[model samples]
Target: MATAAIARPQVSDAEWEARQELAACYRVFAMLGWDEMIYNHITVKVPGEDNAFLINPYGLHFSEVCASNLVKIDIDGNKLTDNPYPVNPAGFTQHSVFHRHLPDAHCVMHTHTTAGMAVSALEGGLQPINFYACNFIGQVAYHDFEGVTVRAEEGERLIANLGDKRAMFLRNHGILVMGKTLPQAFLMHWGLQRACEIQMATLSMGQPVHVPEDVVAVHQRDLSKVQIPGGPGKADFDAMVRLVDRIDTSWRN
Candidate 1:
């Protein structure tokens, strides 16, 4: 099916740049196979705007998203842009909670990958059996699955469980990660998804996976030290954007 052309809403330079970065994020997710059709969403706050943000349009695949096509909406789910696609109500319900509560979280990503959902269903979520898993040892939060997150009231509970953590495991549902920038959020989700994958693989071996608590602690500390602004994540995100362009630059449209 042919995707609709964006109406190109009037936005400032900063907001346009944000749209491009967020559109690139959607493409990267699609490239990594993390996108669950058109279900999951990655939302970023519109630069310089308090209550406005950008989100994937409903019914379009992640690969089909572009800077101009992303829908702009307010905290109350009102569309500020003339978009042909509707916003996902559940997505708004979950993301608005974070954007409103966590003032520092500029980028919020949600995914329903196989490994992520698998770990979410496990009684022991995100085991620290591997280096990737260890990075989130003391940084992960958990929210119990409460059916679909379409209710406006559920946002408060979600916020409460998330606290100030950067990553969260949505019990029996999926994963949520937030960051001060798109790069940080993307890297966080990458690490978390990999950790979940490693955990599942280690469990299938049915053998004791041993990583000393001291070692895990060291790794966690190292990871924390690298969480500086415009750090490695920014460079890596730039590289990924180049890679996506090499494959197909249509996502930049």
Candidate 2:
């Protein structure tokens, strides 16, 4: 865990809360092994600001991230706050598109987990092979890999491909999820990761049992019931937040 050497920024209470939540998400991602070295991103729009948002500083491991260390940036990825940490605008170009174009897209996350990349490389692309996968039937969208996503022009095409879906499969790349809040996005990625894991496991054992279309449709119809109780992904994310706190609470600094 990182020490609290970084000074907390002067900001609104809502923004502070956003920063804490975003920082906790980084620790949670690190705890879950969803981190990819110093790469990957989970961005959240700063409350009461149209273009301002929070993201992980470049070159910091997820485990080293904290509320005070998160970099605040604008729609164009320019730093909006004073900080010694470096910001990688090009790295988060893909995330900016979602944050700009999508409604309620307060949080956008991307990951390069092994199972996620495996499923992305598959020709079928996230088939409904299990319950977790079934919940996203006809809801997940795919965008062809257009190299490192540094090009701003690709955003239009990616948005067109994604339509209104919250989950996206970055073909030959990895997985992406967006949400109105961190908890919702966290749960979405958790389900996506589990879906990929189970799908890979089942495929290795030869022909798997097929889930009838009717069952899949029913599952989709009732996915709301399976959501985090009392709020969208609230209980699930809060529980994980608790677990991460137990491991190391330094993320809140």
Candidate 3:
């Protein structure tokens, strides 16, 4: 079936640019196999709008998402635009909590990747076994799964668990990553997924060699200061955007 072309939303230049970057994030999610059909969400705050943000339309695959097709909604899950597609209630409930409580969280992404889910189910969330894992030491939180996230109180619990952290493990479910910018969120997810993948692979063999706690602490501190273009998330995302454009440029619409 041929998909209809997306008409760009009438928004400010900043918002339009945010939509494009978010759309690019979705396309990259598809490219990296981070998308779990239509079950998860990657959302970015709309510039200049308090309690407003952009999220993927409910039925669209990550690959099918485009800037114009993205839906704008308030923290309460009310649609702020005249979009035909419905928003995912679970997505809103989980993401809105961070968007509303954390002033610095401009982007929030949730994923149900295999490795992430496996790690989430483990007794320990993410371990500092490698460089990627080391980056998350003392920086990850855990939330006990309470079925689907659709109730208001769940948001409260989620925020309490997340408290100032950039990443979280939704036990028996998946992972969530947040950032002050879209690029930071994407990079955080990438590093987290890699860490989970490595952890699972090593566990399959036997107990993995753990980096010394002091050395891990040092690595975390040093890594936190390592910023590249676009705030530690730019270089790789730019490369991935070009790659996805080569495959299909419709996401830019």
RMSD of 2: 1.8
The CA lDDT at 34 in model 1 is 95
* Model 3 regions lying over 4 Å from their true place: 1-5, 224-226
Which window of 10 residues has the lowest lDDT sum in candidate 3?
A: 1-10
TM-score of each: 0.95, 0.96, 0.96
Expressed as tens digits, the lDDT of each residue in 29-61 for candidate 3 is 999999887779999999999789999998889
- Stretches off by above 4 angstroms in model 1 are 224-229
Local distance difference test values of all predictions, in order:
0.89, 0.89, 0.90
lDDT of 2 by residue, 28-122 (tens): 99999999989999999999998888999888999999999899989888888887777665556888888888868999999999999999999
Model 2 regions lying over 4 Å from their true place: 1-4, 227-229
Q: Please, what are the lDDT tens digits per residue for candidate 1 over residues 119-158?
A: 9999888787888988888799999999988999998888
